[model samples]
Each structure stands twice: as structure tokens, then as C-alpha cells.
Target: MATIGTHSGAFQADEALGVWLLRQLPQYESAPLIRSRDMEKLKPLTIVIDVAGTYDHDLLRYDHHQRGFFETFDGENKAAKDGGRPDVTGPETATGEFKTKLSASGLVYKHYGREVLIRLHPSLSANPDALDWVYRKMYEDFMEAIDGNDNGIELAEAVRYKESSTLPHRVHRLNARWNAPKDGPTEDERFETASALCGAEFGEMLRYIVECELPAREIVETALRARTAVHASGRARSKRYELERRHGLPAEGLVQFVLYPDSSGMWRVQAVTVEGTAFTNRLGLLEPWRGLRDAELVARSGIDGCKFVHATGFIGGNATYDGALAMALKTIEGGSTSVELK
Candidate 1:
């Protein structure tokens, strides 16, 4: 029988996830697993991961701890000002790149991810577009977090909530404690439990992306397509939906405003951000409506039912859906209104 090798003593989140991913593949489906640093033992195994000090697909040896290794999901830059360096892309670049460095889990995912997705969601095999989308989406939405956690990459360096609640932290906790008695669980036992944890989380993430996120893109797209008809300015009412989840930009890509009912049931008109750009709204709401609330907001905008427009003009609130649509429409028409809108 074939066997896989990883380092012994303690298992990590990346190796645990990598082992789980490997087990899903046919060649390794029933392969026996071994954890060891003994090169002699690892050398004869069918494959090794998170050990071996090498990353070569042909050899089936994957590890990211070695020096001179730096890779992101398609993009080489660790962090880009606009998700990419200026020279790497031009005006027509449509896709946003992931900035996290890869771990052994990422290495396994980078290779066998599509096959794994197809196996989990067999229906995806019939729809190549959806299959392709979910494949990339899974990496961005799920695997990147695993990779980031495994590599000690945090979203920001700012002082914020400091907590060890991430999956990697949870998996690390499963490792055998130093003060444990002889009756303690073996490393292999703990590793199996860690693998189960990683697998369950990965499955949950995949399900959410497939069932919830991908399908919701249609609502945003439909509203965007009806923009010209909704009004010459292209502002329409819909749920607080997301945009460009699948990167399927609507025709002309000129959607300016979205009118959605907030949690309070009050309507909010929001400016659309241009994809691949950072922090800039595609079209902001009317300047006069901003920074004023209730009666003052109505008086400033000459429109009734106005609640408030954000000081930045990126968003505004109204009492009714029709009022929200009017806010979106006025933003697209474009003119000075007491303030310079974003």
C-alpha cells in the first residue's frame, strides 16, 4: 500500500489540511499516513508534505518552509496598492489577486483543487463557467484564509481584537501538550482529530460559497442591467446585495447607485465602487444631501423623505424606497450641491 509522510512530534494546520486534501485524491484515497522526520523512511513513501524541504509536483513532495519560496495566488506581490503593481497590469485588468503566501495546504490546493471541487459538487462538472468560478472563489473565500493563518499572515497590522480563534489556532491546540501523561493521545491521534477539524471547516466554507454567495450575484447583475431603464442615471432598488462576486461585470459597467433596504427597513442609496480600484466610489450621491439628517437633509436636497447622506456622499438614507431611488438618480445626474461629492 502507498504511504504519505509528514514531520512527526507536532502537526500544524497546513499539514493537517494538506493531508486531508491528499486523502481525497484517488491515488492517496486509502494510503497509509506516517508522521516522521526520518528522511530514510520518508524517501520510500509515495509522497510527503510539510516536511521533505522541497516543493516539486513531479516528485509529489510539497513544502513551503524552505528558503527562496515566495508565491501568491497568481499575483507575485505580497500586498499591492490596488491589489497589483502598476507594471503587472494595465487599464483592462478585471481580476483582483490574492496577496497571501502559500502554505503546504495552498500547495495541495493549487494542484488538485479543481478535481476536489468537481468531486464534492459533481454538478459543477456540467457547468464549466460555474466550476471555474467556484474553483477561484473557493481559494479566495476559503483556502486563502487557511494559507494566511498557517503562514502567520494577518489581515492588518493595526491594533485590534487580539484573539486565537482562527482555525490554525484551533488545530494547533489539538497538538499533544508537553505536560501530558503517558495516557495522553498520541500525535497521530491528535493529527487525525485536527484533520477532521480542517475538513469540516473547509466543507462548510465550500458549501456557503456554492449555495449562498454565487447565486446571489444574479440579483446584483439584474439590477445593474436594468440601470438604464430604471432611470437614465441607472439607480435601482434591490436587497443589500453584493456586486461582481463572480467578476461578471455587467454591460458598460456603468452602474452608479444601489438602493437597498437597511436592517432598520429604511432605504439606503449607496455609490458603487469600481472593481479593481481601492476606496473610490464610481459615482457618489448628491453633495447637498450629505452630512444632514431628517428635516435638515430634506431641506438641503429639495427632496422629501430624505434622512441623511453620508458626509463622504458615498451613501444616503431615505424613509421610503421611492425616496432612495430618487437619491440614486440625483447622484448620477451630477452637479454641485453645497458640497463636493466623492
Candidate 2:
């Protein structure tokens, strides 16, 4: 594992930054402008750093304090809550000999074979830029230090956090946000989702996609042909199908298909789903057909253009499904049919 080890001074120094800065002392001008005594009260600065190829290691430090009025080692231990130092580092002293508030700390990066340690100070965290710079510097310095000297021990693949093993919640939150839904895809929303699912699958799961796509397409085509035959035979009067598919199809929940006829005699089936999950069964139905209609239904949604129809107080003049599809297909296929959404 890649880990770091350091003395207690580093940790205390990190916490002292806020306390010293909030205090009325005039010694440190670069300290953060922290007004609250609570470390949690500090407004966290939003920062994004790129750690493309490298992972972090473990950090270890001694939690003891040095004798003085008060001093912060790192931005982490300004007003330490753990009153006195333990037997881990040095011998105990009088209660007031040193300010029990802040303590020392350090991080250890277990590079190739040896451990590279980086000392931390409190002032670094108080400022966002400083904190980032310190972390990057430490990473570089640790890598360089390990390259210079190795003790024959081989490094492992894991990055262990020896001290406070908790990773920042902010990182997880950012990742979730990155994977959240935005808007519908212009071509087919289902395709986008399928693509994402396929990309996330691993090992054998990835292989299942190749075996499924062909059969799925056949199902979709069959469903489309059935719908067309019904239209031609006049069994179904409505040419417009709902954009959502129901659970009749096994993969109905996986993909959505819409079928709409243009002015042309040919019916177009639009398979809209994520990339790899675009499989259809013999019914020309997509797998993701959960109560939602497939993209194939869109072709049956009357005409592409919007238009308004005025009522002349006539009896029984409602449009039938067969006429609608025929009119739509004609208009779309460059025939003399005209329809509008407005």
C-alpha cells in the first residue's frame, strides 16, 4: 500500500491555523479569517483537482504537542479537543506547559518500496489555494523522495489512509452529481441510457450485449409489422401510438420504441434507448418497455407539423386512427397531404 507516516506536530499544526487567525494576535497576517470557534463552522471552499493517474496513500502522524503559549501545526488541529498527549510519542508534561489545543501531524506515502512523509501546517487548509498547492507539492515530493531512496520493499496497489481513513464526502457528492440526469437526448433518450449501461457492465455482463442486440431488433421489427398490418386491415382505427411502452414485452423496461408513419407508405420505427441495451425481441419490442412506450410509437403520432383545426358544429367528425396514419405518412413521404400541430 502507498502510505505516509509523520510525527504529531504536523497534525496539530494543521488545526491551529483557524484558532491563531481568529485570535487577536498580529503575528500571522496570512492566517484564515475564521470567526467561529467550531472547526465545522468554517465555510468549506469548493475546489476541483485532477488526480487522473495517481491515487492517494495513507497518512500517519504523532499526536503530541510542543511546549509553548499556543501554536497551530497544520490547519487541522487549531483548538484540539483531546486534552493531553498520550504515551505514543514523548513523555507527558504539566497541563499548562504547552497549549493542549493543537498537535503535530504528518502523512506517509508508501511509494515503490520506501515510505515518503510530508509535514503539514495549519495555514494550508485555511486557504483553498494553499491547501491544494500543499497537497500537490507533497505528492510530488513524496514520489521524488521514494525514487531517490528505496529499502528493497515492494509497494502494493492500494492507497491506505493510516490516520483518519475517511475520504472527504465532497468527493462522493461530486461523483454522484456528475452521474445525475440532465435532459432528454435529441435523437433517442433511450439510446443514451443504454450506452451508459453498456459502458458500466463488466466481464461476462459485457459479452451478453452482443448476443442480445440481433434478436432484440427482430422483435422490434415484428411489432412494427404487426402494427402496420393491423392498420392496413382496418382493425385499428387510430394510427397514433403512445410514445411509452407497457410491460407486455420482457425488455419493455430496457428500451423505448416509437412507430410513426410519414407521407410515404413505409412505416419508420425509431429505437430510442441506451447504446448496448437496444435489444428487441420478435415482437419488434425493446427490452426496456416498462409501462413506457418505445420510440417506435412516435411514427404513429399523427403528423410531424403542428396546426389547429376549427370546429364547424358538424356531427360525428372526430378523426379515426387509420385516416390519421395514412395522412401523416403521406405528408412525411412528400405526398400532397398537409397537417399541422398549430
Q: Highest lDDT among the candidates is held by which one?
A: 1
On residues 1-342, what C-alpha lDDT tens digit does candidate 1 reach at each position?
Answer: 879888998778899988998888888889999899989989999989889888788998988776545556664323233555534432134223555678888988988898888878788899898788788888877888888877777666784477788888899999877788889888799999999899989889889888886676556567656656777634344322234334354543456667778899998887766554445666667666668899998877777899988888878899998888877776656642322343
What do the candidate models score in CA lDDT, each in turn?
0.75, 0.26
Lowest-scoring 10 consecutive residues by lDDT in candidate 1?
87-96
RMSD of candidates 1 onward, in order: 6.6, 25.6
Runs in model 1 with CA error above 4 Å? 75-99, 152-154, 157-163, 180-182, 235-256, 261-268, 271-319, 331-342
The TM-score that candidate 2 achieves is 0.16
Error of 2 at 125 (Å): 46
Per-model TM-score on C-alpha atoms:
0.74, 0.16
- Worst 10-residue lDDT window for candidate 2 reads 309-318
TM-score of model number 1: 0.74
Per-residue C-alpha lDDT of model 2 across residues 1-342, encoded as one tens digit per residue = 111122111112122211221122222223332222232332131110011111122321222223321321122222322454332222133233321222221211212111111122334335554344334343332222222212111233464444232121111222223345676332223322322332232112212322343234446445644653644432222211221132232232222224445464434333332331223211222222212222322333333322211121000111344433443333223322111111
